[model samples]
Target: MDEYRAVALGTSFMMLSTTSFIGMGDIVTKKSLDWVLSNPKIGNSLSILGRLMDDMKSHKFKQKRGHIASAVECYMKEYSATEEETIIELRKQVNKAWKDINEEWINLTTIPMPLRLRTESCTYQ
Candidate 1:
């Protein structure tokens, strides 16, 4: 009977450990992807700007005029600027966005699981 109890306890512990490991991995991956997808518009805007920079540098400016024009139009719609001013403004916006994301990541790490659960439970209650 004692040996049977020992085996059952061992099995329960192993199962708990496996479940916890899988749950932790899934939670981390989900959070990472959530952060990536949270600001799709910002990412798209940055990507468009990066492409514009590439086009301008490579003198493919003519080939990519549509995208360049669209980017310019977006920039103009958003802010007033010369070329240098536009670059500085864009850099500032990107840096601010990154700072916000870093703060969110820090917040996620600092919350204890029990506190998080209690807060969530209160929300539902």
Candidate 2:
């Protein structure tokens, strides 16, 4: 009988501990969700802008590479001196744009999540 009683008590304790942990987790998740939802606009805008910038940079790089290839082909055909200069300029522009975009991404990541949320909320309101 004593052994059975001990088993029941242990089981009860285990159940309570599990329940408490789950409840605490739920509370924390709810709080975080509420915070994010409250400032949807600023957060959403930043995310959208970041994605747009990424797409634009990718497109620009592809276009620049295509132009460089065309210029190289022209140079091969005619040995035109200006073709090499054009290729160099295209490469420089692409590299500079890539560097600037990378720097912007780094700066964006530095913003605190909470502050971003706050800004988003203020913007919407």
Candidate 3:
């Protein structure tokens, strides 16, 4: 899958919750707010992880329902990969996204721990 499509689809799912956090008034300072706005990598990672995981779990059901194609379908079509191979590659992507999330959690020290925890925890939901 193209990077933009993957990132866009994933990030769209996260926008509401991320906005809610911003709306909560926790990120009050200009610097903290700027940090949140500028450093979107963690949010992107969460979105990618969530999206791929959901696709892995639900793509078959969705396909049967005639729903729109998921990342699995897209990946398979784009690369001529079998379903099993697509899943394996997607799993690798999911793993990488998790690493990105954890790395951001540890490295993005400018943002407070509570906010970072909220960002990380929301991925599981």
The alpha-carbon RMSD values of the candidates against the true structure, listed in the order shown, are: 20.3, 23.1, 2.4
Whichever of 2 and 3 has more lDDT, that candidate is 3
Model 1 lDDT per residue over 61-123, tens place: 543554324333345446665656655655665566556534543465433454333322321
Error of 1 at 11 (Å): 44
Residue 2 CA displacement from its true place in model 2, Å? 71
lDDT of 3 by residue, 1-125 (tens): 78645554645535544564665574546666566566478877888887889999999999999988888998989999999999999999999998998887778887677766766776676
Tens digit of per-residue lDDT, candidate 2, span 1-125: 23322332233322322233343333334444444445333343443333333333454465567632233343334545564464564455446645654454456543445443343333222
**Highest TM-score scorer:** 3
Ranking by TM-score: 3, 1, 2
Off by over 4 Å in 2: 1-29, 37-39, 62-125
For candidate 2, the per-residue lDDT at 120 reads 36
Off by over 4 Å in 3: 3-10
Instruction: Tell me which residue pairs clash in candidate 2.
Output: 42-120
List candidate 1 stretches off by more than 4 Å: 1-63, 68-72, 109-125
Compared with the true structure, model 1 gives a TM-score of: 0.36
Task: Please say which candidate is ahead in TM-score: 2 or 3.
Answer: 3
